[model samples]
Target chain A: MSAKQDNSPNRIDTKRLTLYALLVAAAMVFSYIESLVPLFFIAPGVKIGLANAVSLLLAAKGRYKGAFAVNISRILLSALLFGSAVSLVFSLSGGIVSLIVTVLLHKTKLFGIVGISIAGAVTHNLVQLAAAVLFFGGGVLYYAPVLVVSGIVCGLALGTLDFVIIKKIKTNL
Target chain B: MKWRDFYIIAAALLIAAVFLCLFPGSGGKTVTVKQNNETVYTGSLYTDKEVKLDGNTLVIKDGVCFMKSAECKNKVCVHTGKISKKGESIICLPNRIIAQIE
Candidate 1:
């Protein structure tokens, strides 16, 4: 088989749809759980972002579009469910940026799923902070350093979680 | 890096955390307060103080204070002792209050 043919995303099928829906549901649950966890001291907006694991896992399976869809659906539904309009901006930006990063770094053979997850988390924060700048009318960019540091920490935790998860599902993926 | 590298990094982070925890703490400097998506107050903190929010203007009497009178369900910030130290904060989520240092 040629490289191009081997690399293309599989055609839309029930299995793929079901898999994506499951991933989205799982991600949403994780997001909800993250909401309950106590906040760490250093930063306010920082979170574990465990929901990203599902997207990263889907991205790893080469269902990038499905993964992107899952991200969008999760953010939209979560915002609607939570009734937090301010959250919509950050969620959309973070999800889009993380999905983009996941797709871009999909080919890399770094620190397993953990490294990929770390990359996704870092990009997510970057995008969210960018959104904050536009929303707050500027000067909020000064918080980038703290946000970045928090992202790195949060990403590492999520990365570790993803690594364990991917290890268990290596055969299925 | 390999998984072992991650382990080493984790160990290093743990050691650093332990060292910082064991070291003596220093009293903090600047003070910042935010509430309802707005920074209600900003000033220098020399010592512990009482923070009160009256109408539009927030008043910090002791040294430096924050957006006072939190109404959050948890009241974690209000219970976080004082804003006398640097990097301290009083956060009330229900009222969207955050008092910290820069």
Candidate 2:
């Protein structure tokens, strides 16, 4: 067998690996910008979550492994730059939930990056609330109901943003 | 993923945003002590928005924004009970109302 044939295809291809690295760097830039941008006048915590758009693009492009790697790198980089350990908690909580949602939605014909954003937003809120309860206690959960409602709204908004950007990219390709 | 899908998603998001913008925080009674469509007093400034004044200072229990102890008069803002619902209000000594979830 040829030497190249002996190795597993799962091993990173240098060319594709480089491309994935570039995508990850771009995702980090977007994540940083997301932190800087103002979400709205209401809850200070909510945001458009634009960074996850990069992940959606990867998943849609059929680079599932590359997409997962991009996700891990982005989360680590974001937490490091932000200088907060607590954020790691929120990120982990949000990330796993989002991945699950994306995979499930991936099977649907109507679903797209828009669905991915909605999943990310909703999962982010759920994880954040769970963290709140664990650390701050139950009383603070009075804010729980409102947060859930807001989550759904924020999720759909971010989802729509993703949907538009993806559509624009697809047409030109 | 298609041209038509874009329009469908956009419309859905527009509706969701509109709904969220209009959602009230908690559902409580309105004090409604306005003069010319302007609200005057609305319970304590910070506590109503939050139970603790800041960073774990004061806590409201049994349904009210209470001062653990302070020199601020109009503790009458004290009368405003803990409100978690939208459109709820507590009138202060200045005839102001603390509106939440509006």
Judging by DockQ against the true structure, name the best candidate. Answer: 2
Each candidate's DockQ: 0.06, 0.08
Q: Which digits, one per residue and each the tens of the lDDT, describe model 1 over residues A22-51? A: 878888899889888857565567788888
Tens digits of per-residue lDDT for model 1 on B30-96? 5677778788665545323444553222335445454444544665655565455555666666666
Poorly placed runs, candidate 1 (over 4 Å): A1-9, A108-111, A171-173, B1-102
lDDT of 2 by residue, A48-72 (tens): 6666766766666656666678887
Docking class of 2: incorrect
Q: Which ten residues in a row are the worst by lDDT in model 2 chain B?
A: B46-55
Q: Would you list the C-alpha lDDT of every candidate in the order shown?
A: 0.65, 0.56
lDDT of 2 by residue, B1-102 (tens): 344444444644564456455532243222223333465323322123333332122333333343343234655545454444445544443433333433
RMSD of 2: 9.2
Clashing pairs in 1: B28-B86, B77-B91
List per-model TM-scores for chain B.
Answer: 0.48, 0.28
Off by over 4 Å in 2: A1-9, A108-110, A149-154, A168-173, B1-62, B65-102
